[model samples]
Target: MNDPTRAPQRVQVAIIGAGPGGSVAATTLAEAGHDVLLIEAGPHLPVDSAPHFRRDEMMQKYCNGGITPSFALSTSMAYLEGCCVGGGSEINRGLYQRTPDTVVETWRRDFHVDGITCETMVPHFEACEAVARVSPLRAPAPPSSLRLQEGANRLGWRCAEVPRLVTYDDKPSGKKQSMSATFLPRFLAAGGGLMPDTRVHRLRRIGGRWSISGTRRGRTLDIEADTIFVAGGAIRTPALLKRSGIRRHVGGSLRFHPMVKVVAQFPEEINLPGMPDPVHSVKEFEPRFSMGCSISAPPLLALTMAEHPDHMTEVDRHWRHMALYYVQSTGGIGSVHNVPGFRDPLVRVQFSRSDMAELAEGLKRLCECLFAAGAVTIYPGISGGVVLRTTGGVRGLPDTLRGNRATLSALHLFATCPMGERGDRCAVDSFGKVHGVDDLYLADASLLPSPTVVNPQGSVMAIAHRNALHFLERAAHGAAKPRSSDGRTLIARSNL
Candidate 1:
């Protein structure tokens, strides 16, 4: 598999994006004895580098496709997305959550996603759990998670420990970067091929097959494959498809888990990341989209916390001590659409007025939790605020939160290439197949119809895994009678 000069090893299937969906799809197809080629648009950066999680790595991996993508009246903050071999799996914080039962029920009932239920989806979840090596945190920060627990416990709000998908070495100090280091190697090992630093500019359908024309090393590569799987995350997947002229609700209905991080500076050198003892995490804000605070200690990244004083003084004493806390918007869903006359497409994500208000409330609550957990000082992390010491400080937040892009960073961007029974508007069907196009499928977060209230990697992997199983089965049957399987006859169980 390491033979680089193998003369363009053609595979039965070509996949884009090396995140959980694409990687898992490759593995599933390969296991079923099909040839799968995994192509990524970026280099594979080593995760062993110090401050590897910093903004420097972010700039290298993200889509700088200019005109910082945002919703209506949003402040200008640079978004971050990993553009490496393993994609976001290499860059994500390794959290795993299945779509909640209620969430799945909503899709089945309200959203018209047929044949979907938590019970029906469980096997695929099990399969993904097996492949991705889902596990609990190696160490739990009771102190940190406890602060959140105390709040929920007092308020009688239910919370639980966050579940994750990660693999640990026995020396096993803590949760390891599971996706790139764990699952990707298996994909590479399973006779799957990888092409890095290659961009899939667009796709063209010629005759009966797909011709994906892109560039590499200043030369053009027009690849023809029997099957193509588009897993280019939420944004790029639809954008690429739309660019290739497969535009039928491909880029509309974009959803993002817009996050605002709050920083708390501790007394000692608590800002240091990756402790010696294997430490796990807590779910103080679980089942409702709030995460804990930590000091996985990146001095360079910790500097983003000019959160206090909102002035030069905090920047001068950058790394004294800092920990990060994040607030996710549960009340919002955004959109992405094509923009003419620009290299980068337009992504418009408008927070509901209620959503923005909830976001502000979450930040205030998180700040309170941090202080309760022993923060020497509490910085609201919003732009233009000196510091908010009391909960009352957040009441007048609309005035402070305006025009100061300091509180923005990207954690999860999802739901562009959505799947549903609603054709002509949704990108893919429940089986992960494209609506209008034949033999084209998308198996990533791109297929998610909306943002999951929690980390979406697990659900994405699970759903795609389930769908892949059925897709392969139907394909196998369809391939047996090639001329007859016009996709209309092989209806997905979800479709039925």
Candidate 2:
């Protein structure tokens, strides 16, 4: 690991945040012989630093120890982000999915994004998947995952195994293709620099160069870059841009997939003690909502059962018969704001009445599916929720989910800084260059125009890869020119 305190004071390109986007951007640039530096606010730990979804992993990898929450009118939704070298990829299940063609059309029509079609995005996705070794399970799906497929089959709903970014070697649980294990290493091999445990507090344009000011181990730190890529996930990316006094259409329109989980008790043993997360997901009701299984580790199971204290003992005695499942819907609007005098930003989300109704309906459908898969009892993730033993009992679920009564959480967040040519609504241009900023681009989830309605790591990497290549091509063609004070340049133009 390179020491942040002694890192170089300047670079040709500085990529902020070591998440999926940043990792891909840094690797692509470095492999092309650019002087790139990847900065991470969290420590650089090994990919297998701790067990997946375990408490120790949360403490070591997750931001805020896996307790980040966004407040709403009558409730708050907890969300998790990875803070380590690989960011969320270090913690997520690595389920991979390309951005749907319908989603691409929406972005092109709504955000006026150019050169973004299913055909155009294919090469980028294939490049990323090739490097990350995206593959299907070599072994049979775990029993827990099979339950989802069986239930969907019985209901005649579309269900399929989601291929993960893993390198299987005759094992059910294969090696995770996290950033730390893939792109970051490739970047380092290509002679890129890494500065972990350095928190960037602000970005300033100084004399046509980007000045990155932050702290490292209680000391002031600064670096100069001829170009910069802000890949600090969705929330922090907007917060950083806003903090740097670049707030035009930045954080105004955030979107995320809100999900509610349920603990289902099966008649037979299905919860294997050391199994990885389920790989199958029901896609029949997609675009609005979807259903999938979750990690049922003892601690996670206990956390999901907090509302049903009376049935807490069930986790201890019948854990072998229990697994966790969720219904996720892209039905919430949100914003990210930098809290004055605080390093962390504030997130506010609002769910419409229709959003709540959709969630309730999703919950009911999830319970029905679980019962069809042979669940004996299902515990809804609600403050005063009831236990249902049969599909008939699913009708007892509420028509609209009450904010204070239901437990809601989200794993996917995006669009705090949407990309497009629409000056009225876009923070960055169609190619990810910030609208009024020069030499500064966003290559993360923040550039996504809207919710992907699925696991977004694949999309994030593909877009970042595409945008970085675009930057390189522009530089090669001498299209990168300095701007006047009215549209100041953050980084100085450099000969590639």
Candidate 3:
């Protein structure tokens, strides 16, 4: 960690959260010859030290033992996000998918967003893929993934391999192009300053400069910068803005793809920890929900089996013959609130009745697919759901599966600080400039206006890259507006 007391260090840019967005932003700015400071609330663990064990990875990378839950009037669903220097890009499955063309068009027309479109976003996506080394699997898909592809084909559904951010050289220990592995290293080589395990407590813009005060190892620290960019994930981003007294639409309409999964027991081995994700996705019912493979490791299997204690014995007996698959349904509105004096924000998920129905339908289809793929037994992680053996058994799925009975987890989270041209509650403008804050911007999933219905990592990186370019173009035009001016003043002065 950089010494916080080393003479009021100043920089041209100070970015909060060293995740994908912040990493990309820092890399670009530093490469452009600007002084940059990157700060992350979590410790910067070396890539070489990333544990091979799942439980150790959870403790090292996850925000809270990978157990952040969505608080709902009905039930709470676990949501996980990385809290390390590399942010989510460090801990997530490297599945990569571009923003669907239809989604981009929808934002352009309905959200009044400009400059970003299906046609315009392609180059940004390509650039990010080039840097991240996104590519297809090096070897044949594992039997588990093959089963998914086979099932989707048997059901006459559209299924395709999902690309991933990995550097595959036909080696066992393939390199995932996480922020730490790629951009963070480049940023450091470009003379960017990074301070980990530092929490920003307050942010104030005074005299045309941004001032940040925070804590590091129980010691007070402060920083001053010409501009600041907050790239904290959706939950923390809005919380930080709200804490800074920028309350307008700071945390509203949070969204996430709530997922439901099943463990399928087969006669053959389908649990290969070394095999990469098959990346096969069933898009027959996309935009609302989609189905894909899930981790089939023993630890996860044991955890899921524990959901229904009766199935534990069976799962343990046939652990090597079992695999997992999941369906991630499009999300509904949720909210993030900053609780005073608390680091963790209060999250409320408002998954509607219709959303739940969609998930139930998806689950049914998933079970049928598994049976078609020769699954001897299928576990839906539902309390009353019986061990399914055939397609006929899927029809009797409960009319409405209660949240408590369902084992749901979500990784793809969006919104909370959505971007739009001029909505009353829009947090940022289309280009990612926070609506009412000058010298401050957002460069993470929080800028997404709605659910993306796909693995959001690729699009998240592309969007951040595009917006960072926008910021660079503006900065190239002139010095940022004096820090004394409020967000409204800066907006009125610039044509951007």
Candidate 4:
């Protein structure tokens, strides 16, 4: 059966999901005078925006924001994520940091992605830095952040002001649009077009073209474009590709930044209650781990742990005087696959026991650092460990902390549709072109290829910029096609 909207509206490029990656790609391609159409799964915000984020509001607009289930060892947790307009960036705290040099080396050596050094990525990072206006998060360090920095400084360990991609103004009173506002506008101004409230349900290969079949604003639509770039993030991107039967090492190999956040109550309000997050730090513990706190706990997140009858009272006492804290761990590859007799794939994360030991060490270190900063009281978030008033009193995690489930909540999911050299057991090539699928592409955090070990917005955007440059150049002036060592025609570039 042919799609109803498959009237064959061809374009130089058809980008899926107008987030940072797609926005950058569209902007670059359009600026190069290529006719591009960007299709999004959600609505585009007004030119000016304000935060009207309510629970229901977040759910209707976000993908499983309020009632999403993520597999924890024996159970599930409600995970919140933004799916509309800017995807994660619209809802994320806008923390930006470059991928650590060590991580780059790993991809270079272990993953065989040539020319992936910090120096090689410098041009790409600089391009994105200019457009995204990347800068170190500016502000007098809050006592809470200062405490962490001071502890690290006193300990003679490495730490720095985490760079974030946000415009700071002393006079600002409310929420501001970020990537969707920044890159999306640039993309549109550069002659990019957007179709929102549109969901591409599946992809069907017809002749030489890939037809995107879906619905938009209550009408069925099918789009025929020369190329399709999937940027639906780590989860949906792989899911959609698998649904479309485009598997070539896709729909699995999931990796993520699993995090644990604790609320450390101070004598006074540490972080401005309800204010936007300003700092996201990754100190000496970088390539292996990261520590940055949340400004406020999400409701579902809060209730999930606090509602436990065992510590209801203590959790309440701590909530009133809390400062957000986080410890992030790099996960080994995990996966979700379509299960028999199930609508969605089975999702599982198997953090090595060795990794767990490392996380325990980091947790101990974080608590120790907080105590050093004159925190009069300490809360060991370990499930059964009594909230510690004297930091030294709690020597070890309660048996509860050892549970596979209900551990520190982590999200920053990535690497399902990783990029590498062709036939490298991952989905895409270094330039994000899906292996064996000519003209099909992937953008978003899903293409990270490995764990970034920190909040990865900067690296993701840079890579997107890099791939978009190569893709756009090829579209406009014919990409240099590579051949076998014997000079056989390996891959050919065709009309846009």
Candidate 5:
């Protein structure tokens, strides 16, 4: 799949990004006999050499060492995404879920997104799951996850095991179903071409074909393709489109699930590396908020504790008993923009006062649940929030949570290049095709018109699969044939 030795070549399709969306699209199109070039901005690390420590993973695969923050006026929330071949699928905790029916309904009714409903998207989701190996736990739930389940049951709130994209084999450490492990291999086997460590500097429409110029290994590279699939996530996709001068309603309407994290000290050792993330979630407060345990990797635990220097001694004393969890709630607008001469785009997220109040309530409820499950002490990961040792202290949390004292982050991001029937407002149409640009498509989380209110990997992959099928059908029927300015076929175009 990787041919760094090859100088330059033209292809029928150029997919910019090797994440789930790009991997799926490349595999599908290549299997259907299209000459596909899959480009990724980061170096490809072998799965066997992938690091286990969170800090090591961040330094290795994450963008900006996992410290990319929004340009907020006051407290900016850090947005975590990957810059490697597999993208977020490689670094994420493997929580795989279908987009909520309500979210799809809203997109259809409000945004006029066609052919994307719970019923219509199921087949695509199922197909994606089969390829990604989405499944339930093979071993028992981790102690931290069980504690969350116990607390939720005590409060009579709903909780369920989250299906993950992992290939379990009775061992504690299962192989993660990242794009590199799943679809990339299939794509490569199907004769798809991959060009890693390549960044697309500019994109131009040269007649009926798209011209792409970029740097690879400190050398210039170029390619011209009949079609371009920009699957470079929500943040980077809009930046690329804007840099390419296709700035019609792009980079607007961004949204994310802003999360507030906490470190809970229980009676037993709960910070187990074998199970880092919680397998369960308290979804009783659906659509608005949710509570789940984080992967209690020591590096992340240390990082969270570092925010509160006074509590470091206590944290270090009982690090084994500490478990990390978070309250993820919906929030308002966030945007991505391109700046000339800058490799990364500027990101800004605007959180409202009401959103802060709701997040405080969520943290309070989470503290109550943890105390019910026999937590001894809880240290809220906020700037000036005090440590709570009793249920009374947990009840008085609202007084301390003044929004300014909170240390928040955004884990899931979307809506930069939303799909809609409104030509003046949306970047892409319902079939994932860019408005006013023929054969240019977006198949990543950027295509989502709004928040899915859940982990979005399944939805992103399903949408990409569905859209790839759409492109396949169009190509089969000669509907996607490139034509000249005079409406004649561009038959002189040569194939690689």
Candidate 6:
């Protein structure tokens, strides 16, 4: 608990949001001998605080109990963000992939992002991967995962196992290499200070420093820092900046992978009781879309089957045979707005006609692959959707999904505060320094110029590593000068 009456605490560097990006940045800066304080809006807990994919885990780790949604004129899509210390890394499956080379080139071409190439980013990615212990499953993948590969092989579609940030020790189920398990610990060991359950409400430029106004356990808390790094994920990072009156290109171009799920039931016991999420993903579509298996825990299956009441009982009886799969596409655009009175920001997303058509086609293709994998029955996630029992049934799917009936969700979100040299579009400069704001930076998914079309944690961490090093280099050159509240210059540390 923080004392409301205490004087404002000052630090050399303050980082908001103890997620993957913040954790990586904090660890790097701290190990370089900087005074860094990492703050999180949620409680700190062990990685295994709750079982993965369970309702209890959602309540414990997810933002808004995993019910955060972005409203569109025609429909709404639910997206999950982690509110805990480790952010999404603690709750996600830890599937890791570098930003595709094509995406990097596109960012450089379209957003004017500089010094970013596949080759230049390899070292940053390798550094983060080494810390997270990223590796593929040493043993054979679970049966559920093999089914996706089998289908892709039968159809001659490209598919392979996706590596994950997990530490394998001759066991089928390995420990997730979440921020709490990896970087956060390193940050702490390097003498970084951590303050959990501290929600920063706004940021104000005070002279040459940044003033952070926040609350901890409902008590007002204030902090002044010579340099500030905002890593509050995609949505909140932009929202916080918007509330602070820094609205240019902040949250205006949010992007995400619109995903639709389906529950497939096989005749055999395909889904084991404690099986991990399928590691294999069909990458035949690449940037346009991708197909992968998802956690089919009984609770999740119940939610996926809620529209089909008649099939609810199937979850209880045939859960061992049912598995969940998803088709996610890099379509649709969204924005984040701060409502005057509401604490949470309003997220509005809109999908175009072409986007709907693509999703419909992706859904049909997903069903075709599932049927090829020997699925006996398929339950689409859309409301009022029909169950398919044969390969020919896919032909009956709508060419364009009905906006009012589609049930869509997204796991990856980014580009809310894009980093580039384009002042007309970008919120931060090439290295993540906020445009026109000295010493203020962004080190999260918000800095992504566009969607990576894949799991983006790896990208977020690597970019953060790159940006943090840049900040340190600048500080070493005396670009960052510490200041006190009274506007007097303080002694600068020579550690960096």
TM-score against truth, every candidate? 0.85, 0.95, 0.94, 0.86, 0.94, 0.95
- The C-alpha lDDT values of all candidates are 0.64, 0.87, 0.80, 0.66, 0.82, 0.88
Model 4 scores worst on lDDT over the 10 consecutive residues at: 487-496
Local error of candidate 4 at 186, Å? 1.7
lDDT of 4 by residue, 1-496 (tens): 2232435455646788877777777777778766677877876664234444456556555675543566656423234555676776776666677787988887777767756888989888788878666555444655567666766676676767765666555424322446676777776777666776778878988887678888877888767776788887777788889889988878678887766555565676565444545374647776667776665544532553452446546445565455657677784446767665654455666666656666676766666666665565555445553465556754654322345433455557778887888475678888888888888899888888888886777787888888888886665566532111232111111111
lDDT of 3 by residue, 391-441 (tens): 888998875555666777888888888888856757898878988678889
Candidate 1's C-alpha runs over 4 A off are 1-10, 45-51, 59-71, 75-78, 140-159, 175-177, 267-269, 276-289, 294-303, 307-321, 337-343, 391-396, 399-406, 479-496
lDDT of 5 by residue, 1-496 (tens): 2345354466778899888888898888878877777988877886545565457778877888887867877657888888888888888878988999999899999889887789999999988888889778877888989999999999999999998998777546677889988888878777677878888888999877898888888888777778999988889999999999998889977888888899999988887655645789999998889999887765677777866788787666787798888998877688888777889999987777787888888999899889988899888888764789998997767643444677888778888988989776688998889988988999898988888899888888998999899988988899885322232212111112
**On residues 331-353, what C-alpha lDDT tens digit does candidate 6 reach at each position?**
89999999899999999999898
Is candidate 2 or 4 superior in TM-score?
2
Tens digit of lDDT per residue, candidate 2, span 161-219? Answer: 99999987655579899998889888988878787877899999998889999897688
Clashes of each: 8, 0, 3, 2, 2, 0
Candidate 2 residue pairs in clash (backbone atoms < 3 Å): none
TM-score, prediction 5: 0.94
How well is each residue in 1-496 modelled by candidate 1, as lDDT tens digits?
Answer: 2432223434467888877788788778767766666777877666543244655656765566212546556643335566776677766666667888877876676556768998999888887777667666566543444555554555554556665555565646544544566666776666666777668888888888777877765567666677889988887898899888887877777766666776656665454345432122334554345755443344433444555434435534644455556666555556666678765666665555555666676676666655555666666557666465555554555522434434665557777777888865577887788886887999898887777777778888887787778778887788421232232211111000
